[model samples]
Target: MPHNTIRTARCAALVGPYLAGKTTLLESLLFAAGAISRKGSVRDGNSVGDSAPEAKARKMSTEVNAASFEYLGERWSILDCPGSVELACESQNALMAADLAVVVAEAAPDKAVLLAPLFKFLDDRRIPHILFINKIDTLGDQSVRAVVSAYQEVSTRKLVLRAVPMREKGVVTGLVDLVSERAWRFNPHKPSNPVSLPDALKTDESEARQALLESIADFDDALLEKLLEDMAPDSDAVYDSLAQELANDQIVPVFFGSAENDNGVRRLLKALRHEGPEVAVTAARVDAPAQGAVAVQIVKTQIGSHAGKLSLARVWRGEVADGMILGGERVSGVFRLFGHEQTKIPTATAGDLVALGRLDKAATGDRLTDANGGKGNLGAPADWPERPAPVYGLALHAENRNDDVKLSSAIQKLTEEDPSLVLEQASDTGELVLWGQGDIHLRIAMDRLRGKFNVAVKGQAPQIPYQESIRKGTSHHARYKRQTGGHGQFADIQIDIRPLPRGSGIQFEDAVVGGSVPRQYIGSVEAGIRDAAARGPLGFPVVDFAVTLTGGQFHPVDSSDMAFKTAARQAIAEALPACEPVLLEPLLTVTIAVPSAFTPKIQRLVSGRRGQLMGFDARPGWPGWDEVKASLPQADMQDLIVELRSLSLGVGTYVWEFDRLQEAVGRAADRAVEIRREVLAAQ
Candidate 1:
């Protein structure tokens, strides 16, 4: 009982897998706390969370939604986070600022695997968390044992069941508090009414209560003594011990509820009020000053039409006020966020999550402190979540060519807002490519470009940097003669083209004798040869070949660098067809990561994509996981991440780099060439 856990405000995050009902639970909690008079349904697009238009259209949470409420004279900020693996960075960033995280899970054994990665993150950071088994109303004789057992396998810490579901005729109707030994009946959309314990569950309840006591006793020697001597522990003592243990992240208390029915939300809130850790403990963990200074961390940023830039931040310590100069930027406004609505708060103090208006330079993941004497932040940035590597990519272009500059500016703003959004100007293809976590992640980014910035853009799979080179060698001679109005252009060059080994790239050699081609024009000839090799007869960049300027004659007065360059270009272009041009496709050495259970499937997936297996080993630092290495064709990597997630319960990912170029043959080469020709013709 460190200060009995009573702070003016506390922040909690709702995190779970997609469609696990976190958004629904947010509405229920707001209702239970009396923050709203009526609850709104997500299906109707009226819920407080998921208020963004992108979320509404997709019927899923595309970002983090922060809402504040008052319960029993205490203030709380609940961050409802997106559950898709594509947006896990949002949840990870918000979690670093939270005092406790409520892991909302479905009450089904099959869906337990989805919690593994999330649980590991929380435990590794020592963040206090609780398990609320949601949607219990869908249960028919809900096997609490089956659900708990399934979750236990993934959780490294212990799980203590705080309540047992009360069932009648194979249908769960209510819950019996294991700590208080009191039974309550669900009254849908209202407060649960107290009821006497049923006789049939008395024995089952006794065993469950005993198990709960033992789990808590493991962390308390005194409690262990009491349990060892067969002496019953007092309910009040049990509550205090459970609260302390939860604060330390030693255990996760389990509760059963149906947010759709508001069945156990009140009881869950009660547990939070008593068990959530105080602000001081968390402020120390984040290295925020204990007192006398303002320290805030920006978790999310947004662009508003009228209000301008909005920075959603958690006040770590001290008071933040409007017009105050912090980190060299004046705060335009300080307000609390409630979905689309903002309440103007004069000054936000410690433990408050607020939206600061128009802090121009303060970006997400930035720790801004007002006390550091012009240093800006708290000496060093706090522990921030890293932006995940981009797994999916598309070449983007403005639909209207006139909007090209505007589109680039809009994309810059979007990338600044979300670091996970990556923009790359492809050097080989000259395409503006946007990379993100998945197809839907980039889709939302593009939607914002259109909806918010009024720029319409089209996306397509980025083209592979395919190259072509000569498989055989040929020698040719050519001359350029152009009569201008005054001086005539005349140049002659004899060159030899030869195939180099793989990875040799394009090379230029000078073997001219006795200044036949002047030193000044020799470089121009090589440049011209490279330009001609850019697009061979195969319509791709050429590589892995060498060209030698054997002998060339240039007139001192008539031949300029341009004349020699033209002659060199003509010689290579004519010789390329005779030298037998071949198409060379790029290859990538991709390392696929997944749980060992899915190793076989990963192997099959690689083989199906014409990938050559390079063996697999246990992923470093990750137990029960394997990293499979393979060399795959660049064309086949477009949708590989999508299929990896599908096969591995949305947790698999891969990283790849250009390995080498191999000659393309058969239908693959013919199809690619045909497509390239059609594209060139259309242009």
Candidate 2:
């Protein structure tokens, strides 16, 4: 092995769109590295990356899975990330610690757009990555060139195709290495068998090789000069230039493979082993000093049923050892993880990703440097992307009343595992609401709550924050008299109520001209009126109104604050209905973001949802995207993201805040009242 290939730890991340075969690629890589004697299939629920119970049940990854092994004396750790957009945060955190990323994608050209967001993230962070087009054998009708072209449309980096598939009667049976100028036939369970260049593929292969050279030469002036001078560069020079440019994130090398059959697995491993940057280089890239006190950054956190809390961290400087202190907590243990299993290790050096047991204070994306013989500094870089806003929510309550107390702590742990989820106590509705990226994201969270945390919850769509306000004003006189025995209660009051402008919350004042009502009892009467305002005849909290206490009579011998409070309550109950109460629904000023090409569709979407369009313009800082501002009823926003994404190829999103409350009249108001009645009845 070369000196650069000396035994050193490096991390790679596997990420892409849902069902892009990232898990399968991880298996193939492990098998090729001799870490696994037999590759387990996802269909069998035995793949190393998706070993969690939740993942097995859904046949998808629910969190980041770490697997480490040694190949040819070099240590390697690969993080298999969830492919669903709902779980993109997991992939992003893992990517921060990666020396390189292998973005696995489908071979079809039309589906290439699915990689846009991932590509943008890598490009923005200047994270070195390679595109591995998996399942090439399944590409019966698609041309590699067409797929490459489509990918290039979204990718900011120059793409260099490293190899061309060698087809036999329209079937991809092998591929020709462009740099080596050699051809090989794929062997299902072993390294590809070398073959002579086929006569029919000669022209296509030569053209593809030339294109690869040109793409790489664009970043290498010496190679560009050599190419312009019509002088061929040696394969060593070409490989050297390729590695250099890739380390700098100037270009993305494209490799094709069929992970299911293990073809191309060995070649990909060789490339990663030889070309991936070293730990020292990664430290320099992130501006972290190459030598310093031990520093570790937690990329993922998992609370295993038996293992307790584990913080998966990447050592950026120095070494981490069991019993070392991090973030004011002792590192209880250190272990190397492979799927669900782990091997206890006493120490981990720089560039090594190991799980530190019982780092309860640690969280994903937190950086901890050695401090006073313990870990410290729990901050991520300022440039890290903010968490995505929630687009869906559910009102959840424990199925069993006894689990109510446990539910909050269970959900806290759940959100800890996946920070994309949010939990809130909706003050308007008094219901516990769980917010997430989509229905799937919330479903998985609920599953964990029940299966792992033992808290079963019943869930439903969140209630809209509907309100009610009076349209007119009225005055009422009320009396409370009770003569059951000694000190019989006697009180009388007159109050005036009136409507205020929209969004003006309930107000109370005393307009009394004399002490017909004692000043101390006046406060008690106002309290009664405000309490009455809590519920309107329309079955919601009343707002945008005021109540004035004009006059009241109280018998000094027989009257108490309770008696006056009851009289005031009766006054409000009778006065509000005659004031013509109207229901008010929350209106959100939503800014819908979508590709410019879908602006017309978004306009139609807004209109169809009973929304008023404020206008639209190009989205700031996002190329080829538009932001359509509109005011929509909160009821209409429940499924708006779903519809918008459907129309925008799953790239659309929006941000919204409560703009105002608009009066709801006619059948809409009646329907809302009926729904509220039904929900209360069910509760």
Cα-based RMSD of the predictions, in order?
2.5, 2.2
Q: Please, what is the TM-score per model?
A: 0.97, 0.96
Q: Per-residue CA lDDT of candidate 1, range 395-497, in tens?
A: 9999999999999989988887788999999998899999999999999999989988889999999988888988899899999999979899988999989
Find the candidate with the highest lDDT and give its number: 1
Error of 1 at 132 (Å): 1.2
Query: Which window of ten consecutive residues has the lowest lDDT sum in model 1?
Result: 374-383
Residue 352, candidate 2: Cα error in Å is 1.2
The 0-to-1 C-alpha lDDT of every candidate, in the order given, reads 0.88, 0.87
* Candidate 1: pairs in clash: none
